[model samples]
Target: FSLYRSYFGKTSLEYHLQTLENNLTNLVKRNSELENQMAKLIQICQQVEVNTAMHEAKLVEECDELVEIIRQRKQVIAVKIKESKVMKLRKLAQQIANCRQCLERSSALITQAEQSLKENDHARFLQTARNVAERVAMATASSQVLIPDVNLNEAFDNFALDFSREKKILEGLDYLTAPNPPSIREELCTASHDTITVHWTSEDEFSVTSYELQYTIYTGQTNFISLYNSADSWMIVPNIKQNHYTVHGLQSGTRYIFFVKAINQAGSRNSEPARLKTNSQPFKLDPKTAHKKLRLSNDCLTMEKDESSLKKSHTPERFSGTGSYGAAGNVFIDSGCHYWEVLLGASTWYAIGVAYKSAPKNEWSGKNSSSWVFSRCNNNFMVRHDGKEMLVEASLQLRRLGVLLDYDNNSLSFYDAMSSQHIHTFEISFLLPVVPTFMIWNKSVMILSGLPVPDFVEGTSLDHQEQQQQQMGLCRQESPYLTGMKNCH
Candidate 1:
């Protein structure tokens, strides 16, 4: 058993060893297969690693692009917000400007309303009415279709006819409120040297109650003097009843401006002032009252002594002397002022003054007699009147003399016509109208000048001398060289 068991053990041992070898061989084979598989797997893992690295790099690039896009979107949103704010500011400014304009317009209307509230009720009503009228007028004028070629008055008349209702309404209101004032149409006519006829008619004849008349000397003064305020009774003309009343006792050679008014309870309307000038009468030499030796021209203004023309025929009014000849003017001054010029050319002896009719026709003129003489003889100038003698001293070499006689003042004044220098003045009261007398020696020619004398003589000038001389010096009617020559036509 031992031997069999031993041999069995040895066989078993051998079998087991064989099995171990077979198992070892198969294990080796499996280990090799596993190694090969592990190798293949390692190569595959390397390739996968490379692919994974590339994928990671791509993923990083995509992440950077996405971040940039997000940043850009945020910036756009911020810019939109800024623009919206600026638009809001602009809208707010525009709203403020609109509000300011509205405030200004409202302020002006408020001011006008306040001013209107302060006016009187009547004044406010008138202003409102006037404003409405102006507005209506403006609207009507603007509505007109202008035709430049048509007649303006005719077109306006047609236009006015359409709106005549408004005019009638206004007129009715005015008539109810007040009476209409009358208009005076006046005409003035000068009848004589001291008389004027005034004729006037009222536009509304029955509307007048009475008339008021006023006159002025046209003394270059704008103010007028009432006729009732004049000096004498002759000038005190009562307001006459008729329109054909005449104004009498006015001064001659005086310009007068007259005004008349038609009066009523409604109102007084004055007529336009009418101007009238009185007549100026000049005297001429009388041949019937001249000396026989004295000769007179055809015009009766010039008188010269002529020995050959001295015929023996004499009248009662003629002077009986041949040596000293004299002449008198035909006209006599009874009222009003008279001015005349006499040219005494280079005379050794000359006399010029006013004398009464009772004076001696053949005797020389005297101071105590009824004669006022401004005489020059042998370079001696004197004024002889009323037995009074005054030596006249002046620088003027006079060739012509101016004589002014104020009948109301009973005064006579002499002036150097060529130089306008005042010579003398005399106060006299006579019973009758005085005639202008002239006497000359050495055959001196006494010529009456046609030059108009200045109307600047002060009435009854017993005061001023230098002022009168200055006034006369500037009042030369003609040149001194024209003493012997006549006025050229």
Candidate 2:
């Protein structure tokens, strides 16, 4: 006993007890974890049962709807068949009655002829025989008319039922499934300044009940997955029956991405996305804002400097004074990118650009802080803003000039449309909406508004850093080599 006590000391006892306690704690933790897992599995089993029942009920409901439709159609077709049978029987019965009447009349004529033949006295026999013979001849001659015109072969053959197509349809019936995706026909799509008409085609059009169109403004992003996930900005139009849909009240000069969904009783499938853009805002010169000597023609699109032009009373909106020959457009632009072209038709001296509504109309457009313009005076080309001018290199043979105004980005650029060359760009932080302004000292200029921005011009816009440098340059004083041209208007 003394030896055993020495081997198993107080430390050994405590270590053994500690090991058992740790094992017990681990076992308790594992038991609790197993219980939680069991509870979750039981809950999942119950959910599965509910889902199964729900799906079965839906299946039955769909089947019942199909059956009900078939039943209604059957009733309608039965009524039609019964109506035809009644009409046919009525016609046959009338024909039978006519035949019976004809038979009875013939029998009576035969009896009269026999009785005339049986008469003993010669005179009585002669008179009776003559009348009877006449009666007999009339009855025999009219046999064709009295006979019923019933045709034995006229059994309701015309009204026979051919339900082969319906039988095939019924045999092919099955549970509804999602329709195939639709395809957007980009070539067939058209757009105007404020509307886009999206055209599409579907292979499963017969199965599809309706269509859903979704669109959102495109911001030059190529990641379609990310764009589709950002549904907050998407606009949805549902219950469309036609294959093509025209979305009105859209922003001009803006790009949009569209998607079409073919929907049925089961579900829906989306088409591949398509990108479309709208033309620039359409505008025409406002005659009310034309200068006194400036003549407008061609539906207010062409302007000319005429010496004998009719003079009118000047208003606050009209361009007045002897040296200012200008006009403003009818539309004011506050947002979105816009593009327009000017047909400079032998016009050597002209000014083209945008100006604020409060800009001074009595002075040259670009001579004040509220306007910006590219001017051509004799052989020199320059851009003027806020009483300062900068010489910009341009072709002397420039016949068509392109102007792109990006209001949201604060950019206004000019290009030689004939040669596709960039002329100049002005960066302005606009405080209000602006309208297209034009000035001419000789000849005429035609305005072409509502044009899409050319691809070359769109890609030629300066980058952020270059635009910053250019903006800084614009903020400086006028170029030293540039000199102010005298107002010849």
Report the Cα lDDT for candidate 2: 0.88
Off by over 4 Å in 2: 1-167, 216-235, 462-468, 471-475, 483-489
TM-score of 1: 0.47
Where is model 2 poorest over a 10-residue stretch in terms of lDDT? 480-489
lDDT accuracy of residue 390 in candidate 1: 50
What is the per-residue lDDT of model 1 for residues 204-237, given as tens digits with 9 covering 90 to 100? 6665667767666664455344443453421223
Per-model TM-score on C-alpha atoms: 0.47, 0.68
Which lDDT tens digits does candidate 2 get at residues 212-255? Answer: 99999988789988998899989999999999999999999888
Tell me which residue pairs clash in candidate 1.
367-387, 420-472, 420-473
